[model samples]
Target: MKPGRYIIPKGTYRLTDKLYLTKNTKIIMDKGARLLRDHNAGFFINGRTGDSFTGYDGNGNITIEGGTLDGNLTARYKHYNAIGLARGQNIVIRDVEIIDVRGAHAMDINGCKDVLIEGCKFKGYDINYTVDGDGASYMREAIQIANHTEAGFNSFGSFDAQVCENVTVRDCYFGASANNPAYPAGVGNHGAVADLYMKNIRIYDNIFDGMTYAGVRPYKFENTLIRNNTFINCDYGIRYSNPNGNGTYDAGKAQSGRNTVIQGNNFIRSKIRDIYIVGWVKDGITARVKNIQILDNIFEGVSNAETMYLSFCEDVLIRGNISNITSRFVMGYYSINVSVKDNLVNGITNEVVYVSDATADGSTSYVGLGYTKDYYISGNRVENCGRSAFNMSGLDGVEVHSNVIVNASTETVGTRSAIVATASTRNGHNNKVRGGLWIKSRTFLNEFTVDDYLRKEVKLIVAKYTK
Candidate 1:
């Protein structure tokens, strides 16, 4: 292992181990350099006769400074990751341009910590097929952090799941179509590796677009933070996937996340579900265990997005966010101890907030209430919503306070109040509205209408607070 600079000449180089890599090695690919991957071109050689690049895991103080890693994606191969890091620490990869990678992730963060992937450009192959290899892998995410059992990787294996910790993706460019139109995703959680969860991953200050999926989609993660990013014209701003991220995980099971935060981001013209938080079902108590927060974000041209489609969560918070042309502000279902407050929302076709899992009919095919309760919606300024400003049903101990609504009634909503709540046909309830105001009327509009929408249910609630 040498500590020296191996300069890649400016030419079309085939990716292999002979090019140069070792402990304390700084292999600099000359600008205008292009590489073709007939096989796995690793960031670091995997010892003797290692054909692929492992990208320095279980090692330390390694840096891969610059290069254009062009995986000749037109063809197919096996056993390759655009970059793989396992058991490595203090690794830095910056100013690298990776293009047309097929059959695997652009980067793999496995059982590593203190890694930084910055100033990088990642674009995945345009095809939809899982090219080659020993498994059902594809050219999927720009970065992947997952845990897989040894048995999952090979036939006869011996090991638990690996854990990735403290990895950061900053100032990178993800397949934004305004530039390349078909860029790939930013990052994804393949699933629990070796039956273990990832810990402490950070995604910050990146520009993402053209992501067929999302800027960042995670699973089985802990204390994850995604902040200060800009997303433009993508299918999903932040998918927050409920099922397995890519659905190809053979690694045991995918666990639910904890203490996740999505803050200070901007999403524009996203086609669906801007901030979708579908919490997974964990073992033990089926209680609402919402430990997520979404704050201070801007969303525009929300088209078909639910804006914030949260479900099966508790103790969640959505505050200080602004939206334009957004469909629904919040569709909180099976949620408890939640709060949606102090936001400005404008939409054209739906209710600004609908906390319903229990409707007059059974729950709609789209929403089913299962003990939905303990929510607070307050101080939000909503307008142009076709349905009522707020609609709640099948609830207990919910509060709607001081929300200012304007232009919220539709022709289809004739004689309906601005804020409506009905007890689910199944659950008896205590839901309240206090200081709720119609902005045009300047006072609390007894627009509070109680109803028996669910097949002859008794009432919307048992009481209300009068000023």
Candidate 2:
């Protein structure tokens, strides 16, 4: 099988048992009509881009093993997508590199199920390399899995679309570098940045670098998992927003934004907050965000000026994270039922935790705005922390115990106490101290622990003298 190009005509069902291409080839779709009508089963394009292929309404399973899809592959003739699987099932695109796509998405899986994309690389079209105002900014994403909205009301045009369900991406890279500064004007606000949205999707062991906006955004999804991915120099690493436009907080409501987990990912030198929760923009209203768990991540040399901000959320947990040389580890407003525990916070000049008022309306007066409850702060070490180690001004029901706090070297006085409650004061027992002076209660006017220690030492000396 020598390498060559393979072209499928429009509105045709091209099925092959084993069609192989040895050299570079271009599979061109003839103009003035649709291309790749029903390539349902067993069509393979191998080798380089000596040619190109266009697919439209390509039903059934079509696999592009390895090649470069030169131009755009559309579904219904509107510069929409590079590859479209309309009403198709069990599509697999693996071990392929797609580049130079202009004004369209790299891969679009609409109304499809059991789709898998593994070991594939997608790069958007380069606007800078092209003549000014001549080329479109490569604004679309590497891969998009979504429902077809145009398929009017139960007519069943595009429904139940699974972009990458049971999908695994390993050792792959995706990038878009057009650099358009102007605000994008479109119907769904397209051409903003390179973004990927999925459901029941798993993105692991992949590297996303140099993106203008978010690297991966899984919106309005359920049972979606993102783990062990490295994001380098991205504007935002990963974002989860509300699918419903209504911004309401109801504990009695059903689990919304439920069971979403982001764990064990490394974010290096992010320009903005590594993880962002962008929900409820319309008059500060959004659907309830609950049951989110962030655990066991490493953030090194991240600027505190912008890092790890969450808003309008509830029932969230953040644990076992190491934040070094950063301004603030976590900042939240109007949140509820959140717990932060067992994280090492070091080398910061600002308050470790900052909670703000909900609004002038005082809607947060019930537990008080910024009030965190059922919080367990234990078994963590904090060194050289500035201002205060743990600052809970307006929060309540927060229990702090068994933490090591070391003050900065420039301070003439050590820290006032291990834990300081700014708003209203409550103290817990069994907090140990070492290598610093302690302040006694005004009524007692004594160091109880130090006095007990001296009494024991003096008794031992007198016993030695009598002997």
Candidate 3:
């Protein structure tokens, strides 16, 4: 490939081997043009001319626009990575249709930067099972943003563990094809390094429908913005994880990153959760995901499902959202400094705002460790909840005030209230409630106030001085 513009005419061309693209190259395909993969090789390989370039400075300044890149349903998991790129910069891919990827990702952005993928369509993929089998595959993403860590996957450029940063994917459509279903995941990081992290990733104005997994899922990423997207009938709209490197290759490294904002998205009939954030705490090493802001989103048909779920998080804010979830609206576990305010929650099956740690994993260790505290739930209009409007348990220093609740605990059998505070240190004031308020301590014997311990320590010091 030379450093010029190559216009492909309007026809279908068969690709027998990997189409290598060098730097400063632009391949523009006309409408009705198609590059059909005929072999197991990758459709396009960026950088690395005959094993000459092999580092972070492999290639850059490449653009591909228009036409369709058809994988032709090649064999599954044979390392057929279409549009494979590694350690490249200033890459732009626009208005292309990528369909029927075999086993790997349709686009692999491994350790790349300054990349923009816009106005594209990513549909169809092959699973790892036969028709009789379960049709499930482990590696699934239309666009995978990863570091150059795994040699088997990131075999293009240098495996120097570079993070993919400054990337944007917008105005895209990810759905099913004529042959197979949609991609399991839209854009994410499947293989995460220990200390490496992706930053400044923006995904917006996209439509994700019927995905088996999350529409946008990122692991070990920071400074990410996922906004104004439409997700329909997916398992999760957005799933973020900051997993502790406990059992993986880097056992002691904790990949803890922060600062993610998910706003103005529309989630319709998501199967599991609209927004899910999960962190980890293993062997006393914690990967705490913090500073997340979820604001002004619309969620519909969230029946029998969690609208938002957060685990092992801190400094989180969920505000100004409208939802009609018939199940739990917002559930937080083993988290701290969480604030949920100014949201209109309607027709909830359980508590509209529930934060506790009594049974996160059916263990009381998290509660005893005091990892759940400083939760503020206020200024929300909650209506028609089958259970309490605000349920607080196994938490410390929780304040619920200035909230309006109507028609709560309607389907309760007995001994339930619109506001239930059990076995936790709580304070409620200035709340306009239409139903009952029940505040009690379930673990009275084990409930030791902070003042009690401070007074006991003072008495012990006096006794020792007198002795």
Find the candidate with the highest lDDT and give its number. Answer: 3
Worst 10 residues of 3 by lDDT: 430-439
Given candidate 3, what's the lDDT at residue 282? 75
How would you encode candidate 2's per-residue C-alpha lDDT over 1-467 as one tens digit per residue?
34344544434332322234332333433332222312221133231223222222324444445444433323212233455444445556666655444444556545445666777666554334354432323333456555432321122243332233344445666764242221110101111111223346666777777555556665555566677878777666775555433312222222234566878888777776677764343333434566778888877645444456766677778888877766666666556666677788777555555544343256554345333443445656566555555555455444555555555322334445434455432232333322222322331122212334533553454355346
**Best first by lDDT, ranked:** 3, 1, 2
Pairwise TM-score winner, candidates 1 and 3: 3
Q: Which 10 successive residues of model 2 have the least lDDT summed? A: 185-194
Position 53, candidate 1: lDDT: 23
What digit string (tens of lDDT, one per residue) describes model 1 on residues 1-467?
57676677778877554233345656677777777776645434312332222323445566877778776655634435666555567878888888765555677666567888898888654444444433324325678776534432321112345567788899998873222334345776644532355778899898887677677787667788899998887777776654432344433333456788889999888877677766544433342334888899998865457787776677888899998887777887767778888999877467788886643356564344345777778778766677777877665555666565655565364455567665341222233343333222212234332232421221222122111
Model 2 TM-score (2 dp): 0.64
Ranking of predictions according to TM-score: 3, 1, 2
lDDT values for all models: 0.63, 0.49, 0.78
Provide the global lDDT of candidate 1 against the true structure: 0.63
Question: What TM-score do all the candidates reach, one by one?
Answer: 0.79, 0.64, 0.88
Best by TM-score: 3
Query: Which 10-residue window in model 1 sums to the lowest lDDT?
Result: 458-467
Point out the higher-scoring one by TM-score: 2 or 3.
Answer: 3
TM-score: the better of candidates 1 and 2: 1
Question: RMSD, each candidate, Å?
Answer: 7.5, 11.2, 9.9
Candidate 2: stretches off by over 4 Å: 1-58, 71-80, 125-140, 151-156, 159-167, 176-198, 244-256, 278-286, 359-372, 408-418, 424-467
lDDT of 3 by residue, 248-294 (tens): 54457766668999999999999988888988887787678989999
